[model samples]
Target chain A: MKKYKCIVVKSQTYAKKAEKVLSHNGISSSVLHCKAGSVSGCGRCVKVEEKDVDRSVDILKKEGVILTGEIYGL
Target chain B: MDYKKTVYLDNAASSFPKPRSVIERMNRVLNENTANPGRSGHRLSLSASQIVFDARTVVADFFGISGHEENVVFTYNATYAINTVLRGLLRRGDHVIISDIEHNSVLRPLVAMKKDGISFDIAETFESDDLTVSSFSSHIRNNTKMIFVSHASNVSGAILPLKALGDLCKKNGILFCVDASQTAGHLPINIREMNISALCAPGHKSLMGPQGTGVIVISPELNTEISPLVYGGTGTDSLLDIQPYVLPEYLESGTLNTVGIAGLAEGIRFCMNEKNAISSKISSLFSYAYSELEKIPHIRLFSPKTDNVGIISFSVDGIDSEQITRFLDSEGICVRGGFHCSALFHKKALSDRFGLVRVSPGVFNTKKDIFTFIISIKRLKK
Candidate 1:
């Protein structure tokens, strides 16, 4: 039972686009409250399992989603 | 080492590389006089009010409105100016006639007021050919209290025939309001000759001024009293809690964008000084781009083939406008995509997709930039 939290940096519009890209790749994830330490404000963040983090990042990058910084572990 | 340069082709949205004078004047205003315009009798306040008055004169002269500094009311933006006129004038059971190419700024407010019993009709534009004034005259009804139209299409850069439509409005005795958001600085607009009762313009776009600066030029004939959108202190009627019943002070409540107004005055001066040169340059660029774009297969152009302001809208086959824009962005070419706030016009034009790629050049743009753009589009085709 591993849990991983992914921080989505960017606008809600971009976050929604990222969510669709992840779902299209058959990845399951839940968005969490956006934490600061990035570009300020609650833009959006996604929480996923520790193991699936690497695969999700790869998919997002390939789909042209700009990821600023990511936080691991909830 | 030259850095990765970015080319701005979004002048229609708002101009970039504003004239040196515009920037200089704005900086001067910020440093010197930052007081509330027309509020106090002190030197700083008087200086600030003078700057705003200068801007008012520039607008009045540019638009051919007959008035002193009092008639030009400062607004937040063209949208606010339009909302002021539409909401202020239109009453229950009154009707308005507008063009299909109106921006959401005009349409949204009118639509919201529709619930209050105001009705409106849209005149269809000739998408295949040039839209003429005759097409507009047919839509006017006896109940039509006002006729509003955009001077140019934000989506296609198609210039409307304002003078002809103005004549028609004059003959029928309908109050004409023009939204000059896309054409005010780039094109020559004479409010009197056009029979425009109210002219609304944004200083940020073609005027090359800072944002939050807008103007509403009221004609002499329009006697209808317009209530202030936001009532507070107009500096004129300090004693009365009610908004003052005057020319500009009636509508302009609270502090104005003085720094932006200073910049606008410079921008307008630059426009007047280099009117022919700038317009010819923009016209040539449009022609060049249109000819170059026509050579590329599967690229559908939305703008007319004739010369116009530095604006163009087109679409590539089987490619989404957003994706093309992204590709262009990667190449350091800036362009605008999506509906361009004219969904109704898009629907009427039946543009293959819901949106089009808009390329609007500015005074700073050169032939080399347009050449690079054409080359980029050609490469994208391959």
Candidate 2:
């Protein structure tokens, strides 16, 4: 069983941007389609390693990415 | 006849001899990745989607809408972008204001919207920025919802006062929309600095991109209010049965022109790298052409002496404007003639009968080309 954390964003655009920001901040991340009823409302979300969740959120926040929901485990 | 010998001066219509990077980028994309962006999760689709996102970022940065790249919506051309902004933003009984020098793209949509109870008034532009701003201010009504004007005239090459107009709109609480067809790459436009709500421009003009690519950059405040002009699938929220409320995907429907956008991105990059030089080079060429054309006997120059966006509008004393252009074409010197699809401008300038010949030089053009154009027009005097 793989453990990962996801940060939901408004759309794929933000997801991709967040991915870039995280990569620049030394965090490895990938964008994934959010499941229905996710905080993003079926848009795309950025998934990252569970260890890098807090740092990734902080990086995206500092970069002004509108984070909709909390970090949820998947 | 060797094609290289011919000079291209119709850049205001569409830039010719696109930047080599733009061409090479488009070719590379078409050869490598033709997948629809954001339509699939596969590697190729993701690559295509990244290309679009990269282009959107470049466009946003170019227009000073950085960090809000999602607000940059891809359309087919400035016409479609203008239609989307005009139709989507204005509702019944909403009065809009436009400049007299608008292309048919802005004029026709507002004309059609009249049937839907939306009305628009044209504010006359003048050589003086103060008078031009005052004219636009005078047309503002209580019901005025938006003030849409061209950043520069396509006919007379008259550059409008965008900052003052943007300030006027801000003071009046009216949305400012600009048609940047003639000045996108030729001028520096910052959406935030200009207080622009919607900025529309084609990629093929000063941006030096291929045809079939344009952008509609929206302010964040108008994101939710401006509805999608075209609705279909955005690859997200598929099961919802309604268009998803996303930033770009909200306004952007259908598959985007990936190859053209890739080319557009490279084009914008080229503009960014040459930003310091593009304006000065084009200005020098415009000055040279203006001085040389003013020297031609029987030539009537319509373009302003200064503050032009690299276009020279002129007419001959006896011959028709189209006839002059036709003659120039025979000499392998390309230039646009006649109304230039700007009847209102011609009517206002009182040149509707003879139209006007427009010689718009691009960044690729040289003083020698303008000299060739001058000598060709000189031949017409004989």
Number of the top TM-score candidate: 2
lDDT of 2: 0.88
State the lDDT at B85 in candidate 1.
93
Q: Report the C-alpha lDDT of model 1 over A1-74, residue by residue, as the tens digit.
A: 67677756343323444555687788886544354443343334666677887888888777655566766567
For each candidate, what TM-score against the reference? Answer: 0.81, 0.95
Per-residue CA lDDT of model 2 for B1-382, tens digit only, reads 7868999999999998899999999999999999988877677887888999999889988899787787899999999999999998899999999999999999999999999999999998888899999999899999999999999999878899999999999999999999999999878999999999999999999999999999999886664378889999887767677887767888888889999999999999999999878888888999999998888778888899898898989989878889989999999999999998887899888898888899998888888998898888888888
Q: Tens digit of lDDT per residue, candidate 2, span A5-74?
A: 8898766677788988898888888887676676524567789988888888888988877677656778
Per-residue error for B120 in candidate 1, Å, reads: 0.6
Predicted candidate 1 versus true structure: per-residue lDDT over B1-382, tens digit per residue:
2223877888899888789999999999999889987665455765676677668778778877633345578898999999999998888998998888899998999899999999998887664333556667777777889889998899888778788788888899888999999899888888777888889999899888878888888885666787778787665425455564655767877778889888988999989988998898888888888899988999998888763566789988878898899999889899998888887878886763747999998888888889999999888888
Which window of ten consecutive residues has the lowest lDDT sum in model 1 chain B? B235-244
